[model samples]
Target: MIALSRKHRTALAMIGFLCLMTGSGCDYRKEFQFSGPTMGTTYHITIKAPFWNSMTSLDRSIREELAAVNKSMSVYDKESEISRFNAIEDTRQSMEISERFAEVLSLSKQVWDLTEGAFDPTVFPLVRIWGFYTGNENGLPDEKTLEAIHHQVGFGYVRFDDRNHIGKCIPEISLDLGAIAKGYGVDQIAAVIRKAGYTDFLVEIGGEVVASGRKASDQPWRIGINYPDPAAPLDLVYKSLTLQNKAIATSGDYRNFRQIGGKRYAHIIDPRTGSPIDNGVVSVSVIADTCALADGLATGLMVMGHEKGIALVEGLPGTECLYLVKNAEGALQEFASSGFGKTP
Candidate 1:
């Protein structure tokens, strides 16, 4: 069974209640908004079109697109494409996947290479061993266990082809797209909106967001980076930016972490170190042309820490990052790329 976090439930109660009352089609100042639960979270979409042929059909299409992505990548679903691939115990067996699955896996490989093994989809074993997957801390693993699990974690152990066939070199190797799948889901939802003859829109899944065109009022879509505090209100923003035809994704350990023996361990495990990131960095938000890229980069940056993360993001064209770090004095510090917040 899929277990929902308190944060997840709170998010659903906050947005799901409104969408439930509005029936997935709410009209506000010539903008139409719709939302629903998917991928263990909720998605909110706003279209600037003054009119559409059928709001119901458009809403259904958005949900269908999300379901398709969930069917392909959801690790919580035992029958999902990724889950089924994980169940394969023989190295000789290769699974033929859908085009969508291939696209996401390709992107995962790209991110893994870019981050120098920081953003690994094969870190599922580490995540589970660290207790973030089951939400039950079984005490920190011993050095021997960590070493064995770390050996199993790397994208290089997995093989994929241009024909959309994927296989693991060892049966113990598994994949998890939790870091990047939501952003891909956002992009897919945006495609559905665009296909339905809408241009100006905003699509948000979990915390990943994609903004296209401008609002009906002719203003750019404004998104706020939340303060990296578990106790902070959802609206407590550290910074806000106006985005037009861009995507932004934020990765932070503030909300998802386990405290072991008075020390906090983040959910984001470093595939390289085989441990939760203890770097002073608290949050990383990345902006790119696609939410998937932003999402993957954000998580990779978190594992890369502040200086290297900023340096890497600055070198990449058409990409920007903002990092929030905790200082030695226990204060929050902000580090951002030169082009960050210049979006308009």
Candidate 2:
């Protein structure tokens, strides 16, 4: 996945809402819109509700739900549940986790198994060694250091008992849930909106998004797919598609990376190799039933490369992907799954 710093994640697309005034033949509803900082990035929510008095209550509820998620999974929080688990060194001791943390872990395991371990949460050590976790760039680690740390990285080492809500790290592995947490946050906020009796809404955190029902204009939410061009001054939309009751996420290396000795190292690390991925794939966009699933799959597909990633998306249900790769002729080539809307 595209690496997001503690400050913010590179927004995948520019979001906008369309509003129409009330007229004789037009149907107009008051659109409640609000944005605020959360989870190291900004969150924007739009809801179509008949009553305008509930805005204050809805906003408070949204903030509280997001804070609850951060407390459960944020590594930057020293006292967070995941951080406390990382501090433990004993392999035999099991730690009890909250239901939210357990849910994220369970979803992560399913993607890990689906991608054959391509989407791994235990790659925090590798992320630090590559200087992604830290702002200071450390060129590259030696062969011995790489091999030793790689031995300690693997999702299989982390064991979880779903029935009892218990988790244990077999080899003292640290987890960086940067790739999947934002998506989970989006899902949580959507749930809060739905529970409050709002059926038409859009919830976006970082770049991951989940849309339900239609906008105030009675049109499906329109989302843009950004072109994966590093030379572009700003994000350029390659195509736009309508989405409802689903989630969309994009992972790309064009924006986040470090350069050393004429070699560029992307923020995304391949768990199987213990290094930054240099594959030709520049970006991957995934659409799924939930933002969390789309977010994890986008990163896993980026590591799997173009052909294999396309094949994997084809076999999965309720999922589609678009891959942008640089060919030998120095041109961008696009490969998309059968279900991915009109290809550009």
Assess every candidate by TM-score. Answer: 0.90, 0.89
Worst 10 residues of 2 by lDDT: 10-19
Q: What would you estimate as the lDDT of candidate 2?
A: 0.84
Once fitted onto the true fold, the runs of candidate 1 whose alpha carbons sit more than 4 angstroms away are 1-29
Q: What tens-digit string does per-residue lDDT give for candidate 1 at 1-344?
A: 22457876676566657977878844432688898898888889988863423478889888788889999999889999999999999999999999889999999989998999999989989988898868675898889988998888888989999999999898899988989999999999998888877888999999899999989888889999999999999889889899999999999999989987998899999999899999988899999999999999999999999889889988898899999999888899999999999844
By TM-score, how accurate is candidate 2? 0.89
- Give the per-residue lDDT digits (tens) of candidate 2, residues 38-85: 889889999987532347887999999999999999998999988988
Q: Candidates' lDDT values, in order?
A: 0.89, 0.84
Q: How large is the C-alpha RMSD of every model relative to the true structure? A: 10.1, 9.1
